[model samples]
Target chain A: MNETALKELLYKIADDQLILGHRNSEWTGFGPLLEEDIAFSSMAQDKVGQSHALYQMLQTLGEKDPDTVAFMRNADQFHNCILVELPNGEYDFSLIRHFLYDTAEAIRFEMLSESSYQPLADISKKIRAELRYHTLHANTWVKQLGSATEESISRLQRSLDSAMPYALGMFEESPFEKDLISSKIFGGEQALKERWIKKIEAVISQTQLRLPDWKALQPVTGGRTGKHSEYLQPLLDEMSEVFKIDPTAEW
Target chain B: MPTREQVYTWLEEVKDPEIPVLSLVDLGVITDVQIINNEVLIEMTPTFVGCPALDFMKQEIHETLNRHGIDRVTIDVTFRKAWNSDLITEKGKAALKKFGLAPPPSRELFTELDVLEHATCPRCNGTNTELRNTFGPTLCRSIHYCNTCREAFEQFKPL
Candidate 1:
């Protein structure tokens, strides 16, 4: 693939992490439960770290520095998973997003951990370490809330019901999935999606909630294609406001 | 290259911000220390990510080197590879055992997260323990409860 296309694709992945991480960080102190709070916070930190590594990879192409890539891009240029761009709903909604997104993330990282690209594999290792905790956290909630207080169960199912559509966006393809696979930059994306669905199905079955027929969801041209929900603009506004104060200032 | 005497002298002054008996170098947390161009570049990994003492340690590293008028020092934390208890030195292992948290039979003998890898009662060696919760006073450790010892102790969770 050409350098421009590669950088763009890498930026999509980096920006997705950056934006999703920003959204997750917003709940740092506010999570409903303390352990979950720390868990969420830790996941957010790891995502930022992963973004840094991806930006470093992007730098190999001699384009925007990590900060500029993080701060300068407008919403139209971003290609993160659509699921990450959605607004945080109720606590259950956040957990739903966490469960769905993180489950996919775990498989994604698992594949990347073995990527032919050394730096990417190395980072995938670091990311997967923290993601294990995140996966556990989300799974625990899926089990607990799926079988917890009436309110908790209801909220969880409702969130899962609504978010299920957007969740499909997580697997939406990028322009480089084929080359990324061929180059062994990371394994085939479909293998990741397959594991993601299977793993989530197994876990969700352990709860009181009925798994949404996986067949019901259809892919949407969300963030993967540079389109995003209304939430992205506001999220980008808050995250970049600090860096934009003096974009050139070393952070 | 640091002479053994110089390295020992440096290690003596650096203490873990959480557990003072432990020195950063002694903990084997400092993997490689190379002094070049009158500047020291130190590579170390934290016991866990989000380790609060790390920021303090970085500051301590800078101050320690500055005290020697070593113009500059860079303390780099690598997370490419996870830091395992095996990374701790024998003396560091002894310190843990003496402190009542028995060191693993030996680093090599311990499988990746051998059941023994979890927190042993720093008060009494107990295999049957319960994690009261995951978070602790610090991010690097977890608060675990030993039913046998009837004590609450901090266990350093593997990163």
Candidate 2:
């Protein structure tokens, strides 16, 4: 088996969860409604905790501990897709991003549940169950707001349009994608992207929102190789603020 | 030497930090207890992956067992197996109901939309209830309103 390919896949997944989880948590006090706040926070906790689990698995496979790996890494060291690192622009944008990103995550975890690696398969099985609720939340809201008011519909449509390129970036294939696929470690980025498009379209069809022709759009890639937006470095710096305070001290 | 049964009994005094009415054992957080050599090892599973009250629960367990003369305790939080709502004991359900939060439905009956559609009201014992919101103030609950009593309450979500 190609160990480097598997590690690359794991790093990207873990980084995506961690970054998006931090973004979700930022809505704790800022959500438009109380229930929305709680919902985002709930998902935030789940994603971050899930990221920790993946990092722990990485540690077992010979890496630094989860905290160090998560908190101490520079933006260029991260392997997350660019979609997760963008600023949560507004409730509309954030919601749209959440819907887009989590749909991909749910499908990704589902595919991973059947992986040849027992540990990855086991963790994926457990995580896939949690992602069900996340997708349910995202789908329900997107469907509701997408069809609710002209204003709501228009706002969501705008957000959707702005997020599409980044959403496509989520499917950026690694150099070792073929190795991972042939080794049965993962179903590969192309397969996951196809599934994600179908799932998201199914939800969008129920709403007034439009699913753009993916082929016409240029995907905002580079995240899988550690190149990131200007926003990622500041976010990483903030995330590690406390941990970096005393790297040697246990809190 | 405290027998395994005695340790279980001692654990009964350890309440879930978030839900004070229910003990950790009844909440299904405590999975296994073993006495090996001079140490007592207890396995646990969290209701949610990032359950904020875990540290407090662990501390409570340590204090509860230590008070009972078992100081050599090791708490292992395991995620190898997923936790299900079915693990909640019968007594735990009753406690949740009495504490003004509806207990979760059986795991077998938790179809996709069933959680929002059906929740017997804790206050009026009424089947006529509406889910106010799927998200609640806490991690494992959802807000609901009883049509009969016109009272809003929380229901522990079926995991």
Candidate 3:
């Protein structure tokens, strides 16, 4: 594969992990319960780790260090989805966001597990191992909140209603969709969509929450092609604050 | 230069910060210890990502190797495979038992339940236990309670 095509692919994967990790980190001390706080923290760290591995892989392709790649990108230059970047509105909102992202991530990772790219394939395998926990955690919460006290059920219903509209926009494709599809870097988007639909449908039915009868949210365009949400700018500002102050300083 | 046996022996002395009776190596978090000519390269993985003991583990690994004069030390942390109860060595299990924590029982269903499930008390060996909570003092475990003992205990989580 050409160098540019390769970088595009690596950056897209890295960017998604990086941004989603940021959103999840916000739950560290704030999750509704202690177990969830720790559990959510684990997912956030795994996402960061995925970014770290992808960044290290990108380093082999010859541009920047993982930290630089993660912290230095411009707001419009990020490739993560809007679903991942939007703020966590409530416990239910966070669960919905996680439900969408992780379901997609698990499917994406399963496909990437067989990627033609050996290094990517290796990382994908490792990432998938951790994805199991992420799946269990998210699914458990959705089930509990859906079946819990009326306060919890109502809150969850409202959160789901509010968040589902933005959650569908996470599937925006990149420039190398065809090459990735043909090369088997991962499975086709159709396969990903199909699995995601089946898994979420089962979870939604179990929760007694209806998948809104409305049409799925339209793709906002450009995230996979390196354009991102306005929410990204402030998030990046906080995330990169230290790095920008002194690039040579180590934590 | 120390031989591979010596490296292993030295690593054995490095106890897990959280579970003192158990060494990080015994947990299989440190998968391999090699002495290549003069330097030591330690292949390690965290039981969980963002493990609070990780910094201390790395530091101890580095310090232990250097103190014994193994030249240099490099620890490669991998998270490719999430750690589970199976990784805890027999010695690690023994240590947990000594510390009055329930070691994994042989039952397959025992493996299925995490801290979220009931674990018999190590002190009283009672099965009438329920999950008290999941946040323990460290990231590697969670707090559980036993009605028999009426005391809270830490359960080594299958992260």
TM-score of each: 0.82, 0.94, 0.86
Off by over 4 Å in 3: A1-7, A149-151, A213-217, B49-56, B78-84, B100-116, B132-138
Q: What TM-score number comes out for model 3?
A: 0.86
What is candidate 1's lDDT per residue for B1-159, written digit by digit as tens? 454357546755788887776678767678777777766777887665445567788788778766766556777777565565567677776676676544434435433333433566767676677765444455445566788878767665454
Cα deviation at B13, candidate 3, in Å, is 1.9
Predicted candidate 2 versus true structure: per-residue lDDT over A1-251, tens digit per residue: 78888888999999999999999999999999988998999899889988988898889889899999998889999999889999999999999999999999988999998899878887787787777778888988999999999999999999999999999999999999889999999998899988888888899999988988877999999999999999999999999998898999968
DockQ-based ranking = 2, 1, 3
Runs in model 2 lying further than 4 Å from the true structure: none
Each candidate: chain B TM-score: 0.72, 0.96, 0.85
* Evaluation by lDDT, superior candidate among 1 and 3: 3
Scored by TM-score, the top model is 2
Which candidate achieves the best DockQ against the true structure?
A: 2
- In model 1, where do residues sit more than 4 Å from their true spots? A1-9, A247-251, B1-12, B15-21, B26-29, B34-41, B45-59, B69-82, B93-118, B124-129, B136-138, B146-153
Against the true structure, candidate 2 has what lDDT?
A: 0.89
Better of 2 and 3 by lDDT: 2
lDDT of 2 at A208: 89
Best by lDDT: 2
Q: Report the C-alpha lDDT of model 2 over B1-159, residue by residue, as the tens digit.
A: 778898999999999877899999999989899999978999987887767888889999999898888889999877656577788999999999999999998856766765667599988888899887777877788888888988899999887
How do the candidates rank by TM-score, highest first? 2, 3, 1
